[model samples]
Target: MTPAELGIGIVGLGSIGTTHARALRQVDGVEVRAVSGGAPGTAAECGWPGAVRLTPEDVLSHPGVDVVAVCSPTASHAALGAAAVEAGRHVVVEKPLATTVAEARRLAELQHERGRLVTMVAQRRYEPDYAYLKELAVGGRLGELRLATTHVHWLRDDAYYAAAPWRASMTGGGGSLMNQGVHNVDLLRWLCGPVEEVTAQYATLGHGIEAEDTTVATLRFASGALGLVSTSTATPPGAPATVALHTSAGAVELGQGEVLRWNLPGVPPPPPDEAVASGAADPAAIGVAGHARMWREVVAAIRSGGGHDADAVDAVETVRLLCAIYEAARSGARVRPGELR
Candidate 1:
């Protein structure tokens, strides 16, 4: 099919939905044909000329919408995705896939049974430094990875959490680790391999919400590599969010869109100032332009009868790991991956 022939529908007109819509407008062979949400003023703000404003159900059932992008709240992801798959439309859902592993697994099974494409938005993996890190780790440059540590200390004020009631609720969405740090977690798993077990501690440090604001977890990967993940919304502004890896051969540090250091044992560490900057590496320029790239991949998969890169099953694994972490924290005992709800 030609570029003009591809029709797209965007569900949820929030910040994330806006990002996907804008990216779709820039991608070749795709059109942002419709948007569905109850957000006041979203129709005007989204700026899709001649775009249909309808309920999510209406959007999914629209004949013009060949691809459905679900950017709605985490709680609604499963329902929306199932609807799209039932309608035989290709789907791209934002992270977590669903609020629970069971829901995510169901979506995966349904999509598979219906022969439809379903993908999770894992944009961070497309970043140059991260892609390179995955390459190095998979190539054994890290030499049987001994340890990995991920820290996300970014600040999100009370106002930010209060922007939407669902921001800090386990039912509506989740806390810092699930909502914000899940991307890092997904990247960690993507680069290091699958998680075997988890033990965690969680607290509501600065927020009045029911969900956790700070979380620290220890992970055991199937490859026998150990990992430490620390994330919180309680940090002061300007604190750097980073992930560092300590392997048998050396260490690597990732901070704010750059590889801060790539040190090999006995080899002098590279100058910190000379580390590659992430902001300078635009995914768009490289033809992996964020959500647009995801859309393109979905289109290709549909046409070629191939599977999506971040399919629902893959996302369920991430969600399972997260659930295990939360459960372990609450019980004060190590949680195995298979034990997650």
Candidate 2:
């Protein structure tokens, strides 16, 4: 390894972890030094023949590991992330941050205490199509956001869940919203603004899983914009997830990787990005370019001592919103994200 290379230690070797390893290969100046927690021989299967295999604890303490990527189950994210930051290693955790708002908040607090960088993987923020949309929406080119709606109607077969049982458990973050729709939820809030309140209803209409296979929610943005979110792993013959925005100026809708519709005046839309692929039918179909881009920016931030695109605090807020949706569904009340303890 070169002296300039940043060493990465992965805490899980499951699908997402393997994906991380593959994506990191596309990033310059970083190497997967070690990994822990997956079936035996998983490292070689992931094409990481040189990555040292060790226990999670050992991986954290390894002298060669400068960054720890926590790709474990949701229930383990809080503890693993805290341990990595406390060990003086920068961290990159997968989305939703944690299973609960309290856990996510505590991790964010610990990140502040340690002064170590902790970034959550919200890779859609790095996709060219979504990045362009964010510029237009956040830059006010869309003008005064009015309404935002996103739908994540994706299908997951019994075999898919059978392969990873955690994908079907609430504590494990196996729900449709947490597992599949989280990026879109994060994107919605990022593009529009904070969600002031949510009223939601969810059910396990299709799957036999403990968590809901389908969920629907109404959001009141702090910007006074109303929004709708519908996610389902039960929907068959799944189509690409979509985020449609209506503003004072006009309206635009984003497909998985391209702009589905554009009606805004005085502003030309970006050319379609054909490289983008949707995980609507198959999770593995989600390409690695976005993840590669995210890692590049994160590595740059770690080297420059600057901030990440999605920091721990920002990630906590997304979890806060997610918790509020569940809470609202249970209580039949208009729950605010901040009201979660």
The numbered model that scores best in lDDT is: 2
* Sliding window of 10 residues with minimal summed lDDT for model 1: 279-288
Candidate achieving the largest TM-score: 2
Report lDDT (CA) for all predictions.
0.78, 0.89
Residue range 1-341, candidate 2, lDDT tens digits: 34489989999987789889889989999889899978778877766778899999999999999999999887788899989999999999988688898889888898889988998899988878789888887677998889999999999999998888888898788899888989999999888889999999999998888998899999999989999999999899999999999999999998977888999998898787776789998998888888889999999999989987699989988898888888898899999998887
Cα lDDT tens digits for candidate 1, 1-341: 34345788989977778778776766667777788874656655555676788888989989999889998988898889999999989889987788887888988898889888888898777655676677777776667788998887766677777778898897787788888788788888888888999999999998799888889999999989899998887776525557788888888888755567778664433323222222212212212255565676777777778887688878888888888888899999989977665
Worst 10 residues of 2 by lDDT: 39-48
TM-score of each candidate structure, all chains considered together: 0.89, 0.97
lDDT of 1 at 341: 59
- Off-target runs (Cα >4 Å) in candidate 1 are 1-4, 38-47, 238-240, 264-289
Clashing pairs in 1: 3-29, 257-278
How good is model 1 by TM-score? Answer: 0.89
